[model samples]
Every structure is written in structure tokens, then in C-alpha cells.
Target: MARRGQYAKGAAKRAEILAVALDVVAELGTRKASNREIAARVGLTQPGLMHYFSTREELFLEVLRARDERDHERFHSPQRGFQSFLDVIAHNASVPGLVRLYVEYSAEATLEGHPARAFFEERFVWVRALMTEAVRHDQAVELMGPDVDIPYVVDLVIAAADGLQVQWLLDPSIDMADRLARLWQGVRETSWPAVAT
Candidate 1:
């Protein structure tokens, strides 16, 4: 019984730490948001904050995970189809700091044995599945053609979105959401049939 109470308290503190860290990252970007600053904001000493997270990388990973959870709740719905994805992309433009964090962390995660490698791996699979389902929903409603290649379209959409994030970070004028929407429009209108044998 006592252990359960301690666990609950620990969970609550972790949640509070994550919430403060998210705000710090959003405001300061990953480069500027030092662990000291985050710890201070959360009323914890640096060592105390480290007690909650195994390492600095793990803390950053958790921040990204928290962002994903919030976005999923806000923008994902089976009935909304691809529009939900578009909405999320559009919303990202407003959070440049988080975008930078995601881009930098994801790049780092590609290296072997990186702590975030598995997180990115799982995230890719989950996102692909989500986007595939959205594409199917669009096709079922005649928003997209039956001939649309679900797997190819899903992969393309994910690639485009990820690429756009990089481009948008370089040039804010890129309009990630609008560009993706246009790409989606083209994908929807075209009938992709097998070419020559």
C-alpha cells in the first residue's frame, strides 16, 4: 500500500516536470533550454530532476513523447481522416522550437545505440499506421480514388511531412501544411495504375 502511494507521487512529479519542460522547450528551443533552467522552473535541483529521468536524452525523449500524446489527442480522429493530419501539420508551424527539437533529436536518434533510436522506430511504425488508416478512410468516402496505392501514399505522405519540417525550419515561408495539402490533393486526384510489365 505504501509503495503504491509513493509510485503515484512519483508519477505526478514526473508529469509536472514534463509539463514544465515542454513549455521551456517551446519557448527556448532545445539548444537554449538547459537542464538547469528546466529544473529551476520545476522547483527541483538539477540532481533532483535527474532522479526522475535516467539521462538528459531520456528527458528530451519524454518531452517529445508528451508532445505526441497531446497532438494525437487534439488532431487525431478516425472520422476526420487526412484532415486531422493536415491540422496537426499546420499547428506545428506555430511551434518552431519544438520543430527544431524534433528535427535535431530525430537526426541524432538515427545513430546506432542511441537511446532515442527505439523511440523513433516505434514512432515511425505508429505514425505510418495512423496515416494509412487515414488514407483508407479518405478512399472509402471517395475523397481519394480506389486506385490510390495505400502503402505508397502513406510512405510518401510521411516523407513529405518530415521533409517539409526540415525545409520549413530553414525557411519559414515554406508553409508546410499548405504544401502537404496540395500534395495530398494531387495524390487524391490521380489514379495510380501499374505501368509497363
Candidate 2:
């Protein structure tokens, strides 16, 4: 149908815009990247860009969404598992903008009735379930303690990862990937003392 074709083209255009915006953010950093600059770099007029994303906030939020989709593809593809999550987190640290933009956008989304609120609220639930499932499986398979506090431990790890992201964004010297790997090692080592060493 013509309508379906139009929607597909629109989605592809939006994806192109996001890819260009990511490069702009990577070069200019999130604080200095502007919608006008992104549009110019992407060979679109500001209004043309607005056709895909009505507002600058919406555009950047959608950029964040694109980043999430990229993560899913690269990290949680057809054969996803616990190691994939760890690998993704480690890989995510290499792109400071990705994590920083996500956190910044999430903070804005916390405001009531914000355009990005649903996006982030749903993202939270998705991430929580993912962590719960991954941790539960690891525990069940004897990778972690069967008696461990599943929800509490998973929450702590997620909090630590997010917290480290904030800190790393504030100061890249923190070595986010190293800290993340160390946290994983710590948990695994603690739970499975025999094989850790």
C-alpha cells in the first residue's frame, strides 16, 4: 500500500537523521550539539529535519532510541545471553555520548507529562526485566548463589552501572569499562569462590 511505503520511507529518513546526529554529538559533544547544526550536517534544512522530529527534544530523544536499538542489535541479537549484557556495557563505555545523552534525556523525561516520559518509563521496565531474567538464570545455573537476594542484587548491579555511567560522563578518567568488569568479577568471585581464583 502507498501508506505503508510512506511509513517505511519516513522511518528510513528518521534513521538517517539519527545516524548523522550521532556523529555530530560524537564530534561536538552533547552539550554543544545543536539541532540546526545537526540538520546542516545531515544536508537537511531545519524545517526538513522537523518533518521527521517535530521538536529538538523529540529528535534527540529519538536519537537515544536509535542508540538503544543499535545496542539491541549489536548486544542482544538472535543469540543473546548474560555475557552479551556484560559485553554491551563494556562496549557502551567507549561511547561516552551514548551513556551521557541517555542519562540526561532520562532526567528530563522524569518531569510529568514530558514527551520522553513514556519512552523512558517503558525502557526502565524492559531493562529491569532483562536484568531479572539474566540474574535468575545465572543463579539457577550455579553461576551465582541460589540463596542470593535476586531482586535486590540485580537492582544493586543496575544502580551501580548507571551510577558509574554518570560518574564516567562527568570524568572520563574513571575507566567505566574497567569498573564494570571489576564489578562483574567481584560478584562472580564472591558467589563462586572455588573457580574465581
Candidate 3:
């Protein structure tokens, strides 16, 4: 019982630390954020924080994961389709730090042997699959044209979203939400070409 209590306390402390780290990253950006700063905010010395997270990358990864969880809850909907995805992208425009964190880790995680490589690999695969499923669902219900090529359309939507995020990061004036909505609208309008049975 005592051991379980200790573990529970540790988990709570880790969550507290991650919460502060998120705010720190948002204020300073991922490049400028540091473990020392996070530790200070959590009332711990650098070494003390390291006891909870062995390295800065681990802490950053945890922070990213927490942000993903919050975003997922905010965006995920039971009646999902293209419009739901657009809504999520619109939400992202308001949280540039979370977007920046994802972009940075995604690039860095591509390097062989990086600790975060696996996490990003799984995330990409999962998101691509989810979008693909969403597209198929739309087609099944006649929300999309049966003539639509599922694989091609799925890849195009995901690619555009990812590319637009980078562009938005570089220039906040780009209006990522509007651009994505327009792209989806074009897809919907042109995707409905009649197919003869």
C-alpha cells in the first residue's frame, strides 16, 4: 500500500511538471525552452527534475504528448468527417506553440536512433489510417462520390494539412484554416462526378 501511494504521488508530480513545461514552451518556444526553466517553475532543481525525467528530450516528449491528448479531446468528434478535421485545424491555428512542438519533433524524430522516432512514426501511421477510414466512411454514405480514389484523396488531404502547418508557422498571415477549408470544398465539389452503374 505504501509503495502504491509513493508511485501515485510521483505520477501526480510528473503531471504537474508537464503542465508547467507546456506553459513554458508556449511562452519561450521549443528552441528556447529548457529543463532548468521548467524545473524552476515546478519548484525543483535541475537534478531533482532529472530524477523524474532522465533527459530534456524525455521531458519535452512528455509535454508534447500531453498537448496531443488535450488537442485530441478538443477536436475528436463522434460524427467525424472532413468538416470535423477542418474544425480541428482551425483550433490548431490558435495554439501555435502546440503546432510548433509537433512540427519540431516530427522533423527531429526522422533521424535514425532518435528517442522520439518511434512515437512520431506511430502517430503518422495512425493519423493517415484514421483519415483514410474517414474518407471511406464518407464514400459509403454517399457523402463523397463513389468514383473517388480513397488512397489518393486521403494522402492529398493529409499532405496539404501537414504542409500548410509549416507554412502557417513561417507566416501567421497565411490563414491555415481558410486554405484547408477551401481545399476540402474543392475536393467535395469535384469529387461528386456522376458514376454510371
Off by over 4 Å in 2: 1-3, 77-81, 189-197
* lDDT tens digits by residue: candidate 2, 66-118: 77788778787323436767777787767767677878888888899998899
Cα lDDT listed for each candidate: 0.90, 0.77, 0.82
What is the per-residue lDDT of model 3 for residues 56-123, given as tens digits with 9 covering 90 to 100? 78988988888767767777664676666777788777777778888888889999999999998787
Alpha-carbon shift of residue 115 in model 1 (angstroms): 1.5
How does model 3 score by TM-score?
A: 0.88
What order do you get sorting by TM-score, best first?
Answer: 1, 3, 2
What TM-scores do the predictions have? 0.94, 0.83, 0.88
**Cα RMSD, model 1:** 2.6
- Give one digit per residue, the lDDT tens place, for model 1 in 87-190: 99998998888999899999999999988899999999999999989888988888877877788988899999999999999999998988988998888778
Superior candidate under lDDT, 1 versus 3:
1
**Candidate with best lDDT:** 1
Q: How many angstroms is residue 39 displaced in model 1 relative to the true structure, after the best TM-score fit?
A: 1.2
Residue 133 in model 3: lDDT: 69
lDDT of 2 at 163: 90
